[model samples]
Target chain A: MLRKLFKFHGGVKPQTNKTESTTQPIAQVPLPDRLVIPLHQAVGGHPRPLVAPGDKVFKGQRIGGADGSLSSAVHASTSGIVHDVVPALMPHTSGLTTLSVIIEPDGEDRWGELDKVNYRRTPPDELRDFLRDAGVVGLGGAVFPSYAKLKPGKEGRLKTLVINGAECEPFITCDDLLMRERAADMLKGIVAMRHMLQAEEVLIGIEDNKPEAVAAVQAAIAASGQSGIEAVAIPTRYPAGGAKQLIRVLTGIEVPHGRRSTDFGVQCFNVGTAYSIYEALELGRPLISRVVTVAGNVDRPRNYEVLIGTPMDHVVRQSGARPDSDRYIMGGPMMGVRLPAFGVPVVKATNCILVGSPALFPPPPPEMPCIRCGECAKACPADLAPFEMYWFSRSKNFGKAQEYHLFDCIECGCCSFVCPSHIPLVDYFRFSKSEIWARERDKEASDAARDRFEFKNFRQEREKQEKAEKLAAKAAATREKVAAEGQAGTTSAAAETPDVAAKPAAPSAEDTKRALIAAAMEKARQQKAQVAPKNTEQLSTETQADIAAIEARRAAAATPPTPDA
Target chain B: MLTALLVMTAVALVLGALLGYASLKFKVEGDPLVEKIDAILPQTQCGQCGFPGCRPYATAIASGEADINQCPPGGEEGIRKLADLLGREFKSLSEEHGVEKPKSVAVIDENTCIGCTLCIQACPVDAIVGAAKQLHTVVAGECTGCELCVAPCPVDCIAMEPIVDTLDTWKWRYPVIQIKQAA
Candidate 1:
């Protein structure tokens, strides 16, 4: 029911190309003979293997345990024999391999014992642990741990829990179809999350483009007769599914930078995530499988609730992907990743797999030089000066590039899409960010080295100072004894200038003390001077301001040349 | 007063004319060479070329300061781009710009690192962590993988390992060609 306001900054209206697949219902694909399950499927630390090689694992059994707080556990998608625990090629931009558990599935899909919990009466902590065990994470492409995201802060005050039904990415309508068909299950999941967060209200934001899905969710809400839960339809926009963007569109409150939406009295979960959560908590099912959209250039483009760790080739073949059509993408065209080959497995984050020929969606245009047309700048949603970033990026002046608010860029690919030159603007930004991080890493290492050197120097100085103090004290005692002897001799034979004899010894201790103080002062000065450059954090801050000033000057200086029109 | 004003105006006009003429006469040929040089740079925004982006880097290359081998994203194509920009012969992607490894972030093997924090301090982007004698970790989002940490690691725990390529990291490589075939 929220009215959309505020014109969003630079974006291109790419062809939705979704109708080709949205009409078709999800179809099942035959399981693969071999499944290569990468340990780090979701966005966190890689899961460590709980079962060694040669272990007989049942379908949906926990084979890989959670490795870190940010990671999730992995379950066997099919009953299989663990063939090997070794490095396997994963589907990523890096094209590198990591540790994976390869399972050679037995003919039968034998089920494992399920661990269902009664959420109505169960404690939230126990439910959280249960969800973790189920490997329930955000199925909205980010693959973030759902339990970790639902955990409330120390203040324990959570306001609105926003269910993100806004599947803005084009050609990926699994969420849309799910809501239309499985609205009841999706709603049940929402209630479970509501209890988990102790949130006051539950707001479901569905994009108006999916009118049927919205109507279905509304009917479901009405049937449940749920209080404090309402479905609000938002306008269709690219990246409208982003937590911050969706929050602003629905609630009119911007999620501040580097802060979670939860900080602003709001929490977000995808429609798919809700369903997954429902299955995990109610059905006692672990996230051993997911819904995938196999669309584009295939004879039949449809959604499938396939078992996780299924190979791409098998899924595509089942979906009727033509053999002549080899180009395959893992997500939506706007921001989806392209796999090098079809051998990669379908991981948790993968929602849409496109197998297309050149005719349906043509390859990107040949890139030309950025002519400073300012179209990219117009397209940047972050209000950054992309042309200048282009300039600085071209120059390898990362410090200045950052000064221009490079980090603020969400890498939405709008600039690249809108560029007259077909410039890969996002690529430049990614490179700069990577370079900045690398430099930061290097500086940290050097600082650590310097600290060790300084600590050693400090220790050495302290040791010298202690040694000199001990020697001086010993000399003083010797002098005191000599004085006593001289006094006794004077009584006996009227001898000696005792004061003159002790004068040389007295100044030595005082001189040594003065020398130690000088050394300490020099050390302090060195430390201060050396520490100045090491404070690289300030470099980002100062450069940011300088970039702002440069942008201001550019705005004032630039007057558009009279067009020939 | 009228005659004096007339004389002043005449002299000013003559001086202005002379100055304008001299300005043009002394002006060195402002070069279009930089643009041509920039055209040769591998347009991949990977800054291994040491320049922020391709154009400014092209300018430096035109001036004959930057090495040709620095671009990894451009790989051979970028070297060719740089070569085209400089009107120089193309060469292989420099091994030092780092091999055409799939893009990866540096991960610190925390256990082996001596907490010397050398990698942390050496990071120009401040991506590494751990205090004196404490374990240091890389903020993955902030790491650039310039290989600046590799040399600084006293214990050699910091590795320039490529991020395991997942469907997430994969991007459609520039297609060999773009032509519309009627479906």
Candidate 2:
């Protein structure tokens, strides 16, 4: 057991409402009539749907293939027929819908062909590809593609693989129960990842609060004969589950800004992610179902092996939520999003579903002016000046807020939890970030429009200048020819012959060439301005050689016959 | 007398040398973490907490310049985190800083809005953009709902509305627990 040395910024010990639902083993929720499986379950781009409409899919069958390097494939959670590939309800706070494979379950949970690949002999890159194909992602709050994090940096110095057991978020014990029950499987997952990453050390950092979990993990590690794996118990604190915080606590390294821990020769994976990795590698199972903790003011607080995209209302109903339930939150209370309605599906990021009455976490205290007591500054865990952020956020100074590192605030609710004024500090920061992002998007759009306009204007101006120059040169050439004809004692009628014969054709051709040049220049301006141009039509190219030749011949020939000046 | 004077001078110089060496060796390098900690502060120029701005407040928090409870904008979460970061005892957000409210962004009712650009001038973040005497519109996404614009609006077209949580805008809210399920 190791004690935490570097004190983090701010946190609060909220009422540990964890025991209410964890007494019973994980229960399997009854299958819903329709399963709306999202194509983009894990972070990154949406997977390409493999099974079209009306295609029959078995339980654990791949229905969507990975579309990008940073995406995961989508699988059928149960044996069902594809009802429709439509924009279905997703478990998101934004309330925006995403494409989902709506399947009407046949009630028979029959699995598809299991590809039992011998992962031991398989290359690490191949194993990673297999996992990605199987649609595995971090079961932690972040549903980032797991395989993406597996690859080492450019140096390929993979040293330690830390299994995060820090269920620091109050009311989340899904990982704990999983460790207690399926620790050996979790170990297998760890070993699989270790082999793939070629990590020398595997450390499972569990909170000391869960002694049972620690013991279970330790026993599992021992039974697996894994000398490389060590279960290290650390002090339980809020945000301990944070990857950066856990990495700091375990190895004493801060994940530098905008870089993954893998960059610094350390790879951190959630215990749940490790377990999923095991299932994918050994059991040939895709990430179809996961253990979700259903707790809070519900009648039954228990963990359930729920299908992905199972609506919160279904889970709440199964848990016997109170009749007058005012709020249903997905994930731990400290940072869980409140569902506007219970219809939001269970996403990969969901760890817990909290159904609570007003009495449990009372509505925050009535708005009060800040007392200038310097309390919020004392409570922030990210070392942020919550008070200052609040002022800037309130004053609508998003730039100032960002300069204060508004993006760094994890929205842990610790500041709001401890505010004497009962101020919802996280809300303000969230608002500020949203505003800043909005402004950035607006500025980008406007900048693009302005660039286009400026480019168009420049092309037009250049075309006008070039056209004027050409017309002047043509007129000058005609006058010089006329003068030369008169000086050479030829008839004025002879000089007029060429001008009369070629005038219409020449002007028309010149006009067309000028127009083309103008168009090309406009397009070139666009191409130059764009970050990435998909086609060449946007580029405006001018024929410089022809114009240069014309000018050069005219300058040298004086009044003698010049070729098409 | 010469010997005594030499001995006294030698002792004085030796003592001075020792003191200077001690000062150089043990000149406490103030906490290296203060600047980073300060960088996280909300740089709201509004001195509602009595500090000139966010950095001063951060310095006060880090170097014990001011109490962590002073900022109203930071609220409870800010105070607790600061305490954790600075290794200070966690106190509630100062009552004087102001109560936390549902985040609202400014919205301009285009129909009701006159060409007055007072709200534009009042916005600290430059969230509002419109020419003087031109029809003004509130960029809902950019408006932080600080309410500074609300006060400055001559026609009272600007209203602070709670940011509608849409699917894209919705982030996973941290879950509150009643029991710790042992993993």
Candidate 3:
């Protein structure tokens, strides 16, 4: 059936460049001598290493335990002996190192105990936990943990489930080939996901450009006899495969940033993620390998079922990488980051290892100033003024850039592709977005510091106040004791010497104290009056000023009463 | 005409009096300016500004008792923010107090610590943990690198280690492309 599709704003039509890899079927790569798997392969917290050096790990064994629900577990691709967990260079644009586990494959190909559950029989929460342990994550480049997004919305049931198989980016055909060949397996996973969401309707939206994948899904749905599940064809457009855009096309419901599609009675997942869900729930197998496409600057561009932590150079070599290939990109050219080097191991987010050569992907023409041609704004899929944000971002005016919603940009390279000035508009947006995040982190740290400092000051003040109050109470008790003793002494004196008692209490502590203070004050006052004037009379004006300053400081100190007083 | 003008003035005076009463009834006390200034100051509480803490220094700045350049930890960028907030000209950092350095946290040499509680007592944020005559350690995330603990440690055990860039902290640099040069 033909479904009415909604259009997302401002997408560019770049060459698909996907036919080169999709023509071939997915093949497996031989296990390398070693693997360096980073613990942080997803969006959330890094998983804790579950194995230590000198430990034997079985195939599909959990090597890194998920930190929480937001983090997915990590498994050893094949049976191996743990070599050491150390900081190794990661596949990020920053070229920084993170904690990774190194393993030397023993070639045993052994499986440890499996923890598989019936996806339908188990409760939803328990099933989600199982998937998390199985290391099922979105393989559509976002690498979000799939289990975290599996729940129903506030309505307690989903209205529609959208399975993403668009593969809209140029030169990335991993999902396309996966859907074309493994449609039945993906259908099983889709059914499990539908059960988890309890969705009323299921629609698998594949780009019309890939008629083969669409036909395969339709055939699988028909064979399964699931009338509720339908495959819909979406128009071929750049970024049409984005979760929000795909949801909009399938259901005509626009899901904004900071909002879940489930809230709008719909949720979406990548076809690869659904396939992993099937393998995890049905076959009792954990996710350890994925389909990665090696394209661009390679003699034989193809797709391979690459193991996690298999080095990129090793995979590119399998595809006959040309000598001119100077740079390696991690994902599709549109949104993929340039790998620091080819040596960084393929992570969960590696959908394509796009090798770049100067001949195939020339250095960008030197950037000319933006012409205000409005071409970038027209190509921006997020409906933002890319030129206006470009000005703010270039000027380091992050506040203004935020006002323009700079983060809404998905960095799909659509604007940069369409820009007449060749400004590398996407790079500016990335820089601005990172700067904003860094500033926010600094702000949080400073706020935390302020809270701690204020709390410490408050604590110290309270302690001082408590000590002062205790001293005051003690002094009051002593004053009462002295008063009682003085009264008795005054009576005894009065009784013994009538003349002295008639005048005043003599030889009492109170009387003596009062007399000493009064006499001391009188003497000091007289000496001050006598000596102050004499000293000032001979002193220079500068000395007099110094005296006045000292007097002011003394006055300031004298205002607060002493605890003893 | 005179009677009409007199009645108009009477009504205006009555409304003015009512507005004044309302303002007094609902007026907020205390200088919010001090709070605004305090929010701009980094709360390291190193006392390099000759004040007890950041709050006291903020209060002094708000009242014009202290200059805006005294905080070295805040650096020139912070001074710019302060100048923008207070509508003053940006001045160079006051050198007599200290110089701005990279963000760092203190690390304690446990071998040389001698179980002294000096660093623990010196930490303004209580980032240091351990009781008297025990092994003291600094919580890296909570530390502000104020360097107050360094001087107080008799064994000279505490050292400030500058934070290095990691995947989590790395940022994209501004683009520098030359189109004309390429031509």
Question: For each candidate, what is the lDDT?
Answer: 0.74, 0.75, 0.86
Candidate 2 structure quality by residue, lDDT tens digits, B1-183: 999999999999999999999999998866766666554444332234554345556666777767888766555766776777878898876655544667667788788888787666455445677887777876654554445566546676777688655544454332222123312
lDDT of 2 at A11: 65
Name the candidate, 1 or 3, with the larger TM-score value.
3
DockQ-based class of model 2: incorrect
After the best TM-score superposition of candidate 1, give how far the Cα of residue B130 lies from its true spot, in angstroms: 20
lDDT string for model 1 (A39-150, tens) is 8887777788988899999988998888777778899999989999888777765667777888999969898998788997987777777787789888888899887888
Which tens-of-lDDT digit does each residue in A41-97 have in candidate 3? 988888999999998999889989999648989999888899999999999988899
Worst 10 residues of 2 chain A by lDDT: A445-454
Q: Docking quality tier of candidate 3? A: acceptable
Best by TM-score: 3
Clashes of each: 64, 110, 0
> Which runs of model 1 end up more than 4 angstroms from their true locations?
A1-7, A153-155, A460-565, B1-183
Largest lDDT belongs to which candidate?
A: 3
When 1 and 3 are scored with DockQ, the better candidate is 3
Candidate 2's C-alpha runs over 4 A off are A1-6, A462-565, B1-183
